[model samples]
Target: MEFWRYYRVIRRRRWLILLGTLAAVLMVVYWNYTTPTMYIGKTTLMEPKGQTQDGVPLFQSQMMGTMLDPQLQLSNLGNIATSQKVLSNAAQSLAELGLKMDPEDILAATSVHPERDTNILAIEVTLPDEQEAKVAADAIATEFKKTYDELNNQALKDSRNFIEGQINSTRNAMVKAQDALRRYKEQNGVVEINQQLADSVQNLYLAQTNANQAQINHEAAASRAMKAATELAKLPESQIAGTSISRNPIWERLSESLTDLETKKAAMLNGVPGQPRRGPNHPEVVALQAQINDVKDQLSKTKSDYIASTQQAKNPVWQTAYGNWFQAKVEDVATGAQAAAAENVIKKMKSEMSQLPAKEAELAKLQVDLKAATDTYSLMKSKLDEAKIRENQGSSEVALRTIDPAHVTEAHNNGLLKLALALVLAPLMGIGVAFLLHYTDNTVKTAADAEKLLGLPVLTAIPGSKAHSLPRQHCPEIMDVAYQMLTSNLWVATQNQADNGIVMVSAEPDAGRSVNASNLAVALAREGAKVILVDADLRKPTQHLIFGVDNKVGLTNVLSGGATLEDALALTRVQGLLLIPAGPVPDNPVKLLRSPEMKEFVDQVKEFADFVVFDTPAGVTFPDPVLVASQVGSAVVVHSAGRVPRGSEAELRQRLESIGVRLIGAVLNKVRREDSSSFFHYHRSYEGVVMPQLTSGKKAIKSGPRDQA
Candidate 1:
């Protein structure tokens, strides 16, 4: 239901939505056509495998390896491709090619990125001219490669220089070590130093054997002392000599009570040997058992309070163990002293051995220093050679490779995407506007709105006509049915009332007040009742034109005494229906309608016709309708659907009610097809059935025609 309501709103404002959408689409198309075309040039590069021609690693250092990693290298290359240095060089190159481009412009046009999950970099340049784009892409790539190579080569040069310095330092150190060794040998007269050192080592080994024996004996004595100490710890410090136990008289009395209770319980249960053995359930047995438990608890408490005494004495076994422990500890101390003396002797022997040959020890140390320097010089020399080789071979060619040269291609204009977006957004924007207008529109569009505003039921909703050129009889059957329904509702509302006059009024002009009034009169006349439609709107009358009658003299004439009500009445095409045009424009319709003569005119019309519908101008703007309604004693408000301003109907209704006029409900006039109820859809089924036109022999009344009903 909600969707249908929104659909009706869109349908009512379809032309507005269409125009807005078309304008948006045209704008998008014009923008796309007027936009300049752009050309793109792209270049591709790949990371080097970091392998030398001789199947050796080119970058051996941790830093070098990181700099050459595939992912990291590709990322660095991407940055370099768009760097200021590369872009400036590219701009200069472009200037040479007759394209005076700025570095900023080139930078703005250029984009560099690494391909996902691949050791590849893509550099793109977009420009209006194809040749410029291609040249710029190529220049940036070439410059980036050169810059990268220069960085790598500089690193290699630094490494080579460092290695060369180490080599020089190591050579000097090696020479010094050789000379020091020769001097040490000469000064000490140390010949066959290894043989002399071996003799001194043999003597040191014998002394060490004696020290080991002393250490073993000390360890054995310490173990014995530990065992004796453990046994001593297990012995008691003091021994009990004798002990005595004493019982409490209270405990003895409780025990005797418990025995007596148990004896009585047994007698109660055995029942004197065989007379009658009582069961355990006997009350006497239960009582005796509880007494026994009480006595037992008391005895247990008394036992805990009993006293005990003892006499302490020395333990012979403990004394013997203590003596043994002391003797072992004394022996352990003596052994420890002997082990210390042995250790001291070994230290003295080691000191004597250390003094064997200082020149031999110094010569050995100098020889070790010379061997280390020689090895270091050899390693640095090899590294320096490798660095020089790496520097000679260009770093760029070994570290990076060009996968694809820059080439020209047409850049994507995204015309289709823009067109699609415009197409999609245009309707959405239009719909949004439609809803905005819908919510902002303060008018009655449906019967519900009228009823809600007027606080009264809606009589009927008259479907609007699109063919103004056609005659009224040729109108669609739906409109006729609507008028009939209105007439029926009005009859039911006013059937029991004394007054037969109804003043038709509207809040705004062009609300089809006159048309509704004429149609209602026709509907009532068709029901076999006399009907009179009075165009009381003296300022602007339309009933004459609606019924094809002359408006030379009407209600105004009758009220002004220019003619009687009978003389002013004009016959219409509808049977049993008479029309009274509003006649000449009045200077003051309000004063005339409020006069007593107007009240007399309404009473006369009520007596002449079964129903009298007085057509009036906009009640909200003019007091003519309200004045007429006061004399007529009843009012029927007619409002154009979706055209009456908010609160206008309510104000008009309040005016009528304030004058003590009976509100006969409202009629939603000029309702569009979309706003009509579903019940009205049956008109489509009757579209093929042509409605018969009712014709009367009586001709239309011209000027001065009187109808004496």
Candidate 2:
């Protein structure tokens, strides 16, 4: 199948495409008309600024600290703007307008979208009605600003209070420190260090202890020397030099007894105990005392001499020469004096500290406590002042401005958008439906579809002839176009195959394939080909009228081997053309067509003629054409333009090919010219192929006129 042949079938199926397109387009229009409408509105918002307009001096200084951003003292201002609390107030504010609407209903339709690269936020409101949508947008935006202003004044008060506390605390702390230092000065006298008194007291104790210890040490030394001398004197010459006390007990006892006596005696005053006369004594005591005195003086002088000797003895020197006794005496005296001094100092300090509590660390702690309390009071005071200012600010009225005033629109919907969408989609859907039909029709889809289904090559596409042609007697200009295109297609087809050959034209009954055949024969004859038109559709053939030939003895007489060649071959009125009309409708057309003699007849005709054209029945429904297609050089399919059967072309081509017939081309007869402009895309190449109007060509061809048998 060739491209041109595929194009012919599409041209025939044009009605299906057109009908499908119109149905889809109408449905789209209907749907668009029935859809409901929606309306939208918007209000632009200004960035929130913590600014006040009231003329009041008391709170103005405090407000200086209230900045909306940077510190983010309040970034949730937008949240407050759309808050339910704000919305409720805004709705109340609108009561004077007398539109009864729920706060939730108004809020539901409201939305906020902040702009990038800018501080402005736009509030959009959507509703069933445009006017309502617009009014609600304005209401919500205005109320949001009021609520934010009130919140700002309160925030300023909080800042002022926070700062005031610090100033108060600093002042109070300064006062406390001053008071503490003054009290300490007033309570304690001018203090001085008594270095001379301390040094004299220390010397007095040292001197007393040293004098007493000196007396004790001198006596110990005297006794020890006297005892050693006595021991030496008592020692018999042998053990006398270095004998220890234990080596001679009697001598040692005697020596210790004598030393104790001397030491006790020294502990007394020199003449105070001469009779031990410091205290009262009994008569016996008096006598013993007298004796003791006498002995003491004697012992003293003796001890002195002996002491000198013992002191010269060979024993090494001792520690402090009675160091323990002297040390005990000195320590006892020093301890008493130091105890007295420490008691006096501790007593003085207690008295001084007790007298001036305010001048001590306790005073500083009191000052610090007072400062902290005062600071707290000042801060709270500032907060209270700010709260007062805020309370006043809230009571003040807020100002409002409008960018776009609310107004009713003429149309309540997006009419332009709706109309635009309908226009674009309707036609698109129409074209979509046309393709659906093209795909779903199931006739040969393309030239290739036909080729594959039919196993035959379709050669040409013949534009259809008009049905009104015969009644009008003009042969329809379309008939002439069909004839010319058919001839040109064949001319092009056989130009390479042979100079002249057999050609067949066929279609369903009343499809005018026979008319197509007769006209095509005349057309080829005019071109100077020795053409023979065979009405091979013997079962129900109609070529006799189209060719004005007698059907009494035609193809049947010739093929039955009953009539002479001249009798069966009738000369058509067309010069260089001949017709073997279907003489009578046969009972078994397929059997007659398949006969051996009929095959012989086609071979003989081919030997005699330059070209042979057969007018066979529609190849799709009948087998006659297939049996005859084997006999002709080439058979052409005649399709009614814009009216070819759903599967007929595919089936027709297959019938011819199954019997090994070579299809020459197709004739699209009875074409509709109304939508020719649209179909011109397919018909463009065949433009000059149609004979130039054919007025002169009709006069030159003396073809036989139509005669009903």
Quick one: best TM-score, which candidate?
1
Expressed as tens digits, the lDDT of each residue in 1-709 for candidate 1 is 8988888888888988899889988988998899888998999977666543221122222122112346666767777777888788877877887888888998899898898878788889999888878888888888888777776566456556655776797689778877887787788775565876655555544454445445544654565568668988999967998877787777777877787888667656643321234578788777778888888877766763454788888766677667656765766787688778877866775676557676554554455456655665675577668767766774644566889999989988888898899889988888899989988776678888777666778899888786421226666667767777887898899888888888888877888887778878887777677778898888877778878888888888999999988778887766778888888988888778888898888887787777888888898688888888888888888878865343456667777888798887888887777776543465546655766745544423222325334
Best prediction by lDDT: 1
lDDT of 1 at 581: 87
User: Tens digit of lDDT per residue, candidate 2, span 419-484?
Assistant: 666657655565555556655554332333434433445443444444432312455444555465
Off by over 4 Å in 1: 6-10, 16-39, 49-76, 103-109, 127-129, 150-394, 397-399, 410-442, 468-474, 526-528, 545-552, 678-683, 693-709
Query: lDDT of each structure?
Result: 0.73, 0.54
Per-residue error at 417 for model 2, in Å? 11
Model 2 — TM-score against the truth?
Answer: 0.44
TM-score list, all predictions: 0.60, 0.44
